[model samples]
Target: MTATAFTSPSLSGTEALLLDLEAERCDAMKRADFARLREILHPSLTHVHAKGQIDDYESYFRSGGTHVDYRQIDRSELKVQVLGNTALMTGRQLLVAVRKDGSGTVRIDSRVMQVWTEHEGRWRQLAFQTTPLAMSVT
Candidate 1:
């Protein structure tokens, strides 16, 4: 783990939980486990796609067209901010996905921000937004 200059104990715990959630989400995506995804997401959650499309929890689960198999994901520079019962998580993620046909692969590197709220003593994702990171010109 890289050293961070500033840290908060509460934020640390939130960050840990968010990281765990991200891992579980990745697993669910790989297995197309809608049930698990449903559990993690709040009832009124909204997911904003990179393509300017917005999906509510119900719509996202019903899409059924997200069949890409994720090969791996790399996450870094995560920060969590806690406000009362809500938390905001921000980070960078690199994801590699392959089509089921085995024809090719797609890689995406993006910056993500997610809002999670504690409901009934458990945290659930309320909203998530992601933006593709611009490649650096070396």
Candidate 2:
């Protein structure tokens, strides 16, 4: 129920800051708040979906509601590394999405890698990619 990397005694304050920013980014996505999403995303943000589709910042914003609506996102197994002005984040995400009819939800579990840049004491998402994970057979 915890991320060891973030809990490590050797992890610096910068690491914690980046981790917090990551949480904020996830919240923004679930809410689908365009303004917050725009502010958090870099102008040149690059996003790669699990199906290998690529999206730039403007494309992503413009494609809202046609498909790919996220109702909730739960992140786990997070590892973050801060390198000067950028942070790299890897984690497992459980994303719940609404059906087109709005009657039900579907879950997509994926492994995600996100890149964040620090600018003038603020963090912005620069790039992100997610890979779908096959469920384990018990």
Judging by lDDT against the true structure, name the best candidate.
Answer: 2
Candidate 1, residues 37-137, lDDT tens digits: the string is 88889999889865668989888876522656767666677777788888888888777777766767777688989999987878899998878774321
Query: Deviation in angstroms for 7 in model 2?
Result: 5.5
> Clash pairs of candidate 2?
none
In angstroms, how far off is 106's CA in candidate 2? 3.4
Backbone clashes, candidate 1: 0
What tens-digit string does per-residue lDDT give for candidate 2 at 1-138? Answer: 223334667678877767766777777777677788888888888999767888899988866323556777788888887888988989898877775556666676899999999765688889999898843211
Model 2 alpha-carbon miss at residue 97, Å: 0.5
Q: What's the lDDT for residue 60 in model 2?
A: 82
TM per candidate: 0.77, 0.81
lDDT of each: 0.74, 0.76
